[model samples]
Target chain A: MIELYLFLFIMLIAAVIATEIKDLLAAVISLGAVGFSVAIMFILVQAPDLAIVQIVVEILTIVIFVAVVFRTTHIDETIGKRFASTHILSMVLFSLFAFLFLAAVVQSLRELPRFGYATMRVASEYIRLGLSECGGANIVADVILDFRALDTLGEATVLFTSVIGVLALMRKIGRKR
Target chain B: MRGMSLVVKVVTNIVVGFIFIYGVYIILHGHLTPGGGFAGGVIIAGALVLRILAFGVEPVSEKRAEERASAFESLGALLFIGIAFAGLIIGGAFFLNFLPQGTPLRLLSGGIIPLCNIAIGIKVGAGLFTIFLALAAIKYVMED
Candidate 1:
């Protein structure tokens, strides 16, 4: 529990650093730190699958971000330059929004069941019969690949579509002679 | 992008193969382990990205690699859909577990699940690598 809190703290600090930093590359690295902290939090919460995916995806994202940064300007020119009235107004509005978001989060947190006591209807059945039906030791795999295969298929289609979109955009407009 | 230092290249040459194999292992044993298609596929893509970043290649060869990645991506998607169509045509249901479900906890078990994992693994790995290559190959107009 304490370890989880520590990770959460690390994530929050890294997130703030990621947003507040001036150097684009440093900011990207900070964001990677934030992501790694979140991955650690996932592991602490006993979700190794989520942790593995989060770690790998985070690494790829950081790599992509760094590549983009390498091809562009390194320093952000706009940040910390001036504090205009509009900036102050936006900050005020952001704080208000943050307060409201916190209130909503608190309400939702209150509604959630106590830790380690989550109740389930469909999940229980999946746990009991997933092996016999799907013949897999990993129930999560069985659920996703067998019972919810349509969802997986839809996700694959979505990925494929995005890849096509990227290819189209890059080949047509992203290159100039 | 230019190649990194020789140390980086050497390390990548040593590590990339292991990473690719590990991704395949994850995908193959998904039904018996925690990671499945999506995570394993992402890992494989990461390995490719690492290799490309460490050892930059000629633009011409990179273009060829990008085209190959695109083809592989399409092939994976086609294979997944073909599997579903096969299940429909033979079993009269979409994504039916038509294959024999062997004993649980074994590699050969989980009739259609492992197959789906492999298909998804291929699709995701190839797709992500294609995206990265496309992004990297983009010509920056401002460079002029």
Candidate 2:
């Protein structure tokens, strides 16, 4: 429990500093720190599976960000262009929005079905009959590939499209080809 | 990303094979474990990325890798759609579980589940590698 709070506090600090930091590299690394903390939070919530996926995906995302940052010419020009006077106003606006979003999220979390409880009928049904009907020991595998297959197919299609897009963009004919 | 030190290259070479095998294990055992195609595929891509990081793009042939990854990505997507269409042909519903569902706890028992995992694994692995490779290649070229 204490560890969970520690992770949350680290994430909060990372978020604020990552945004406030002027250095792009530092900001990117701080954002990754937040991702790591969130992964830890997932583990604390008894979602090891999610934690695995989150950590791997987060690592890849950070790699992509680092690659982009290094590849680009104007590393600091992005945030440097913003007026100094507007920074104060934007910070105040950001704080207000962040607080509102946090309140809304907390309210939604309160409305969620209790964790470890079997109140969700469809989910309970999946757990109870998944092995018998789906003929698989892993209920998650059964649900994604058997019960919710169309969604997976859509996801695959999107991945395929993105790959194609990247290849096209990287064509040797032109830089943005 | 200009090919890390010699020690890093040696370590990456030694470890990447194990990571690739582990990813395959996770993908194949999706029916009996927590990890499935996406997690396993990402892990596999991570292994390749590790190699790229240690070896750099010039030696790795970013162009060649992108072409192969693109081909495999297309193949994986086609294979996935082909399987789904096969199900529709056999079972009269798209994405239907057409194969016989065998006993539980076995690798080959999940009908189309394992097959889907394999397809997803290939699609995701190749796709992610391609994306990273493309970005790295562009960055490398622009810098040069």
Candidate 3:
């Protein structure tokens, strides 16, 4: 649609402007704006979860940059050298890679089975019988907490490991001081 | 540093308060809403950054705040693990929702999920706050 094209055009312009901006702080703000725009696009594409994650990550990244900039006032010196030739080359390569990957994903999307069919045949039957077997009220909850409990356990373990890692790092820093 | 006009100080205070309140709202409504622990926590951290920038770290008592944040981080992690272990002790699998599911689509309905969100919010907020403080401390030490 015309609106989508307009949005894409604006995003492209914003991306170029962000990259071209001489001031590091301005560039960072512009990049954040572009990220927000992309997040909106993700929402429009029916990926609300991904959109939220993207926006959150973008905000964190922007805050980190702002903190760094405040501590170090000389932004011009921090802006690394910009080479036109390498930029173009890399851009082309990146575009090609993205195009190929997107093509594969689109192919997969077409080939994938519809969730409704599987749900009706496999999941629904299991759910109908699950109350008698699992003693859970909700079928979906039963599937997630009971049938796939191992996966949930693994995820919890991963969170535990990361928290431990963070603690260890903090302690190590404390000892160094 | 103390020579700043009253207008600037008032404006900065209002802005900082707004950011902090917004962050808390996001964290509290995370389970039923779009915003979650990480987003809300980062927003809170941003408010701290703004406060530090407007009123320098010295005025804010950054070191003491850093210590408090570290304690909060530890408590958050502990609370998260404790919730998980509670399920195991209740004869259910790990991380199981032991409490009654009051009603779906309600804020208080998702028993463990809301608790998990709170724990995550605390962990993220404190973790980020600590990192910022540590980084600032490094700069402070180097300058001194």
Candidate 4:
């Protein structure tokens, strides 16, 4: 519990640093830190599947972001050095919105079941019959591949479509020479 | 982007094979392990990305390599759909377990799951590598 809070605190600080920093590369690194903190929190909640995916995705995204930054500029040119009245007003409004968002999150968190107490409604069946029915040792794998396989198929289709879209958009030559 | 320093190239050469094998292990052992196709595929793509970043591009063949990756990606998607179609024909349901489900905790336990994982692994690895290759216009190598 305390460790969770510590991670949340680290995440919050890193997110703020990511937003506030002027160096684009440093900000991207800070964002990576925030992602790692979230991955840690996912592990603490006993969701190794989510943690593995999150950690790998985080690393790949950070790599992409760094690549982009290296190709572009290092400094953030949009933010001005001098503060203005509109800046102060926007900052105040942003703080208020953040406070409201935090309140809503806290309320939702309070409504959730206590830690280590998973209320398995449909998962109860998966636990009881997953191995015998699907013949897979990993229940998560069985659920994704056997029980809800259509969903996986749909996801694969979506990925395929996106790849096609990328390929179509980035073609170098349209006609043969 | 030319090849990195000698030290980086040597290290990458030593480590990339392990990463690729580990990714395949994760995909093959999806039913008995924590990782599956998507995770394994991403890891493999990461290995490819690492290799490209370390060794840089061979000036003339990157387009051909990218085309090969695109072909693999399409082939994977086609294979996945083909498997699902096979299930529909045999079991009267899409994505059904048409093959015999071996004993639990075994490598070949899940009937169609491992097959699906392989298809997805190929699709995701090839798709991501294709995207990286397409997006990064690293045409000019750094003249030393």
**What CAPRI-style quality would you assign to candidate 4?**
medium
Q: Write the per-residue lDDT of candidate 3 for residues A1-177, one digit (tens) a residue.
A: 465566687788888877777777887888888888888877776656457658867877887787677557625753356557988799799999999999999999987677335534766667576444434443443444445545644554564466456545544244543
The top-ranked prediction according to lDDT is 1
Score each candidate by Cα lDDT: 0.89, 0.85, 0.67, 0.86
Pairs that clash in candidate 4: none
> Backbone clashes in each candidate structure, one number apiece?
0, 0, 0, 0
Mind giving the per-residue lDDT tens digits that candidate 4 earns over B16-130? 9999999899899988988888889889999998898889887456778888999999998898889989999999999888999898888988899899899989999999898
DockQ of each: 0.80, 0.75, 0.20, 0.65
Better of 1 and 4 by DockQ: 1
Off by over 4 Å in 2: A1-3, A67-83, A174-177, B140-144
- Give the 10-residue window scoring lowest on summed lDDT in candidate 3 chain A: A133-142
Better of 1 and 4 by TM-score: 1
Quote the RMSD, in angstroms, for model 2: 2.8
What's the distance in Å from true for residue A139, model 1?
A: 1.4
Tell me the lDDT of model 3 at B84. Answer: 76
Q: Where is model 1 more than 4 Å wrong at Cα?
A: A173-177, B140-144
Candidate 2 lDDT over residue span B1-144, tens digit each: 588889999999899999999999999998888888899999999999988888886735678888898788888788888889999999899988888889999888889889888988998898999888887776556654
Per-residue C-alpha lDDT of model 1 across residues A9-87, encoded as one tens digit per residue: 8888888988888999999998998899898888888888888899999999998998889877899888896599998
Model 2, range A37-150, lDDT digits (tens) per residue? 999898788766678789999999998788677766425655656767888899789999999999999999998876688676888888888888778788888888888899
Q: TM-score for each prediction? A: 0.94, 0.88, 0.68, 0.91
Better of 3 and 4 by DockQ: 4
Q: Between 1 and 3, whose TM-score is larger?
A: 1
lDDT of 2: 0.85
